[model samples]
Target: MAGIQDHFKRDANGNVYEVDFKYVRNHVPLNWFFEHMLDAKPKPMSGAIRYGVCPNEPACQAASVHSVKVCVKEDSWKCFSCGEHGDVVAAAAFYWRITHREAGLELMRADVDMLKHYIPPKPETAIERDDSALALVLQKVAEASPYPSKDALAYLGGRGISERVAREACERGILITIPNDAFQAKAFLTEVAGKELMERAGLWKPDKKAPACAFRPLWFRSQSHCAAEFRLMREPRDGEKKAMRYGGKSPWIWEGQTPDDYMLVEGPIDCLSAVEMGSKRTIFALPGCENWEPNWFQMMAEKNVLMALDPDKPGYAAVEKLKPVLEAFEAMVGIFNPPNRIGDLNDQLKAMRGLI
Candidate 1:
């Protein structure tokens, strides 16, 4: 890791934000940083990490090489034969084409590297990425109208949701508040990303589509009111009334920036509840019961995660499916059963607060 000292700077608004690259890099575990080294499976260490032949070195994977010692329990690996082994920083430096020092520096100064002229990612160069037009429209709408409206707030509060949670829900796209006039949403989007792209993004609802909207020709308007399908306030089948269906890549909403521990809860609202009650550094909101992504496990590989999915059938099934996957990483997996099948963590919290 970069051994440089931490430095701080103040923004125009006098808000002090952390710019301590070396310090942040030091905190990230070496195994986690160099996880790419474990990409190849010499032999599946089911529920454990074993020292075997090196996958990175082709000569090692084939035979008589007991040179690799992988401490799955410790999240570390070593190849004595080739003398190539280390934590995430060393592993990243080793594999990366650039100089070892450069790779370490890049990892440490990640935030500063994102500046336009600071690094690659030019039009015809380093990085390539794709974006869904529909998703873009949603992003644009979110950027413009981030805060929840009075109606949105009241609607959630009426449904036993708190004001703080209602605000978070709107900001994260878990819930949306759109103008009553459909044209307002369209015109607002058109003004943002222009007409041609918006039309091509499939704003007009086709009759044959899953949700089956009659006329949703405009982009922003269609997503005027939507909610992620997390069963928080009540059962998903009964409680969730929003028919707004969208498809694309969505990540778990995290209020707390740290990735150390995750209090995996069913609904984003439940996550909010956990955060509001001071579990802010340790909880993450799962989008739905069976909505985990493959990369999510690796993302939380080092975390001490707690699964608090609803105790209902679907929720239980989700937990069963995920338990083994996490256990494979040697994670301490625990099931949190809300009393009497009353529902998620939020429900229990609300009951305790006498808000229910």
Candidate 2:
């Protein structure tokens, strides 16, 4: 960390000016600045600071608190949930909503060695992971628990999903069901996923040997099938609170080819509903409000985007945060709501079919 008093030189009239960009960028301790400025918590082991509140999605409830992390070594910050990342100067600009030059000046003025309380901790030992093996195991799990099973079809029917759409989703391998019988699921995974792979892939808990999704029967896979969200068929029992188990980062669930316009929805069900409703625009479904990726901006650049997220607090908040981000990438942004003030796209499908 640079000393606070050395960077600025006083003129005859006491006007302070910054020395250079290198001094502000390299000499300042980013961790200390984030700690003092954003009230972030330092994770010494990771050599990063977790933002106390993510500036991108301040009101978001789905993503865990402090989901945005700033790497001390790189002096860069990234919000994992919103996919917003930039350097220390950009961080200041985003937080204060100011120009880059103004942010640089602010950094220069606040230049101080505050490393007394912070020590850069060494990185943790690298874990030898076989991602290919994990993908293969998940594929086997999906194969073992095929979609359109009795319970899954029933669940889809109750949700007002057309049989045709459900069949198409099954063909795409986007949806599957784990065996309702825990013993049966365990036996199958023990052979297919194996104990070592499951543990290493974080598909199994450290204390428990069985697959994490053993009891979670409803499975929703990403388009690439690299990640999955395991959902419970029924409400969680006593002493169990979580209704979903997410494995790996969620990928965008894409539908339609290269269309000029794109419609963004909350989940796969809504995506299917859009297709069933005869929507011609390309559809990209995020696993949830917090899962939008930054790289998607490139694909959506100079294109029209419609946000059809759920008509709820979290949904609206996410849109409010994401709309500007898309716009910044030169994507035209619009908001879509269900007709007759229905809940979501799925509810709209139910209304369109007189199933509500």
Candidate 3:
């Protein structure tokens, strides 16, 4: 007997009215829609979520479908893939390209009892946990002294990174190079943590009877705890020319509350360059073009995003690849390529000053 008229009508934004369907949404569970209406399989769900491809996205229905999130409460569903959002009936309408009334009729026919009868599972006991043990290592790395001597400053100058910026970064532990006096680095790290932790964090390892200082990222929590970043400013040494370039956790961002926009760049150095040029937008440096998730997009759903990805071939290619991921966040992205066609933003700044 339940048909189109049973559910309420549309809204100014063309979305199904949430208030009218309050009773149905409360009774039916989200998993019910997936199992009965969509016939889609979600990875074994544990929490209050069931994630899958957006039914509105053709590519998503095929492979790597993590764009749509259906919350346990059947009231709402959002598709990061197509930016399609709606209540359960609206979600079904978007998926089937039908009127909200028709979608409601379909739900009325679905065996809602299967979902409605379910009860939430009990929570498990809490236990101590530390997934990434980089916090203490970060402190130890921060304790390691910086290279403030003339050679260190000159090295930055040669690289076109100004002395002022370097000093500001060094004081705040944003940018720090290997202590030219390797012994100082050893003493500083040892005071904070033992030699073994220093080795664990990879400050340096003895090679050929000398402390071959590491040129890797030191992970640290930024001022905004939600955003994290790593910096690598080690002054290159002769014997360690080919030592592995270091990297830590991938997700990093500059200090900010969730801003109205984001300034995405290729590396942390490029992010600092944009900041130096006076951009207050939250700067997020991609670990690399290939990966960009497992992060805080849920916190940025309504924000605009501008990307100053590098101007080179790889940079362009990365942007192209990232279109899907950004779309999934429903981000309004502005492609802001460097004006001077330099490889990256930092290079553009340096080139303008004739430092390169």
Candidate that scores best on lDDT:
2
| lDDT of model 1, residue 248 | 39
Candidate 2, lDDT over the whole model? 0.68
- In candidate 1, residue 292 scores what lDDT? 65
Provide the global lDDT of candidate 1 against the true structure: 0.50
CA lDDT of every candidate: 0.50, 0.68, 0.55
Tell me how far the alpha carbon of residue 48 in candidate 3 is from the true structure, in angstroms, after superposition: 38
- lDDT string, candidate 2, 1-356, tens digits: 24555656668897765445566777556665676777666554333445544444453332434233334445666654445667777677777778777787787776244544456444443344455655776787777665566776777677677677777777777776666777877887788768777777656666775665887766777765667767766655533323443455555455676577899988877887887777778888888777767776677888999989888766887898888889888999998953476888988888777878
Better of 1 and 2 by lDDT: 2
Record all residue pairs in model 2 with backbone atoms less than 3 Å apart, i.e. clashing: none
Which candidate achieves the best TM-score against the true structure? Answer: 2
Candidate 1 structure quality by residue, lDDT tens digits, 1-356:
13333444447996544444344345544433333334433332323444443423443342243323433334345553343555545555555555555555555554442322332111212111123665565566667777765654554565456788667666556554544334664465567655544444444332322221112211212222322231122222421222323443343555465556677776455666676556655566665666666656665675777788776545777788888888777777766654554657767766766777
Candidate 1 stretches with Cα past 4 Å from truth are 1-131, 168-176, 180-198, 206-241, 255-259, 338-341, 353-355
Off by over 4 Å in 2: 1-131, 145-147, 239-245, 351-356
* lDDT of model 3 at position 13: 82
Candidates ranked by lDDT: 2, 3, 1
